[model samples]
Target: MERRLIHVITPGDHYSPRTGSAVPTVVHGLSAHAPAGTEPTVLVARGTYPDRYTSADVVEYLPGTEPGRWDRRLDPLRGALGVRRASSRPWAAALHDQDEWPPSVVVLHNAPQAVPLVDTTRHAVVLYAHNELLRTYSPREAALTLGGVTAVVCVSDFLAERTRRRLPPALRDRVAVVRNGVDGTVFRPGRRDASAPLEVTFVGRTIAAKGPDVLLEAVALMDRDDVHVTIVGSSGFSATDPLTPYERRVRAAAEGLRDRVTIRPFLPREAVADQLATTDVVVVPSVWPEPFALTVLEGMAAGAAVVASRIGGIPEAVADGGTLVPPGDPRALADALQVLADSPDRLAAEQDRARRRAAERPWSVVSAELDALLAARLDGQVTA
Candidate 1:
């Protein structure tokens, strides 16, 4: 049987050094799963150009201008305009022209702006919604785009359920849940120095939803000399924007403990494994309902005992591998931190379980399952 071609469309700003974005991770994982003769093409919206991925069969750059302050203030209006503009670009025209590829399937990764382009093409379309866009987009916009998509694949049951409730009845039945996986090979346990202080790391953008403030507050409450926390990633896009209110609070909370709490810019993806390898524990105190906490998975894969909020898909991701505290509760987060610090044996055992759990959900396994889904869809063997 001739292998079918799969075209992936995404609006994610790729090529960044950050390792936590689910879109790139999913795209990379899916590429690994491409059938023996199948070709997988990834299309990303242009940003500050990304580093080249040698493994990708084809990486197409699409044009999109950055948003201005006014645009930021009026996000919904601007986002709609941006999507409409993006849809008319030459890149989108090129994509539309490629209907000749006789693409077996089209996978959209949160590119509601490109829905019209895909709709014009003659291929089975699956929208992989990573976030609850219904909450972000107007009902009319959601109905026009999401309603027309053939299938919806959500990363977590929470997102699936939430999306289902907002979607038109016709689209609700098409939604499915497919959890993201981690690359276990790169994120395995590392050698730890017993003499080192209990080091904790928080990775991701310094945003309000991530709840960096709660982490700082919890660290401040602990006030332990032996505990160290490192906050990685940029605080704000520009000095004018400053850090978010929550990030500012986090900074303020870490005042006296400043020496122990380190804030650094985003690190390269290749370097993240090494950083996670050395850490004793990783913290993910997100205030919002994260659809799927990819950082938690990466942390667990690195064999660090993960301490995350028990909200959204985080509990599903952590499962029995790590500890969970209620979201936005400094006391609970502090207690979890203290437990890990006080009991090295418990931490080690949790790390062992995390390593085992991560090993079972490797990208190869995830990709194979995706390939099967794509093949089945192409052969008319499966229905939404």
Candidate 2:
């Protein structure tokens, strides 16, 4: 029997202390829990920093432009132009050079242009959409890039629907929804001191879009000394990256809370897990339309009562595990936080619900679902 080689491509650099994006984290989890009999190898862009996680074999590819603020700003423009997407061609060629054996499955992450770059005639190609990136492609461009792709896996139902809407009707059936998962082993609940003040934490990029400021504003409105909030993260994944004006504004808001709030720079994955484990309440106050908030699931997995923005796929992720508040509304957030802080029993119940909910969606389940999808694709069977 032939070896089952699965090439999992990342959108950019893999998980490193300096790389703060969720894509690498998700990749690491999925690969770590991958199904038996399948070998998964991750392909990442060459970076100065070493990978933090070694769950799978990783190969480096030289991307046209490294992940940076300027590259992110120009993504829409690059996606609009079909020729510009050719930057991933080198990555495609490297696929063949990796080994003597060909990959049975090629999983492309986020980059639509790379879908057509793969030799679909030989390999079963799958496009994993971590964001609503498909909407940026023109109809013709979408059809061309996704023509021979076996499936388009979206991280959330919200993202799947968004992906379908952007594609031609004929190609929409190929879209599949596979929500992101959390690693319970690392993110499981830790000891929480009931005697201490309500521990509130906001984790993610500390930008206006992520609503770190909104969290600070909400905590300020409560005007209660019994609750403490910790804002963890930076403008980017690298601690060395200069703080943006938005980050500065968020810090300014935190300053008003004085002893009530503690602003910290971005930490590594393990540190993030540690931060989540200790918190009583985790707030995801994203002001923008978040496709899905990984922090929401992570917080829940850590046994923290979650209060998050109800916009986009967050409601889907939170479900019955958390309290939802209107995005960017400090008063609403304040009320939600105050309710939990006022009643210890209520807080404990929320925490229990969150942990239970997280247990039901472990990384193992996600890996099994994705494994079945890949198996079906290779067997010429279409999965919904």
- Alpha-carbon error at 158 in model 1, in Å? 0.8
Predicted structure 2: clash tally: 0
Candidate 1 segments whose C-alpha is farther than 4 A from its true place: 1-12, 15-20, 45-50, 61-94, 119-121, 136-143, 236-249, 380-384
What is every candidate's alpha-carbon RMSD to the true fold? Answer: 4.0, 3.2
**Clashing pairs in model 1?**
15-50, 187-301
Name the lDDT of candidate 2. Answer: 0.80
Instruction: Compute each candidate's TM-score over C-alphas.
Output: 0.85, 0.91
Segments of candidate 2 deviating more than 4 angstroms = 1-8, 62-100, 380-384
Give the C-alpha miss distance for residue 61 in model 1, angstroms: 4.4
Tens digits of per-residue lDDT for model 2, 1-384: 232545555545555544658777777778888877667777766653674577778776565443466665675677667555545544564464534446567777776767766665566778888888866678877887789888898888888888898899999988888888898888878888889999999999877899888888888889999999999998888666898988888788778778999988988878889999999999999988788899998999999999999998899889889999999999999999999999999999999999988887898999889877766666743222
Largest TM-score belongs to which candidate? 2
lDDT of 1: 0.72
- Give each model's whole-structure lDDT: 0.72, 0.80
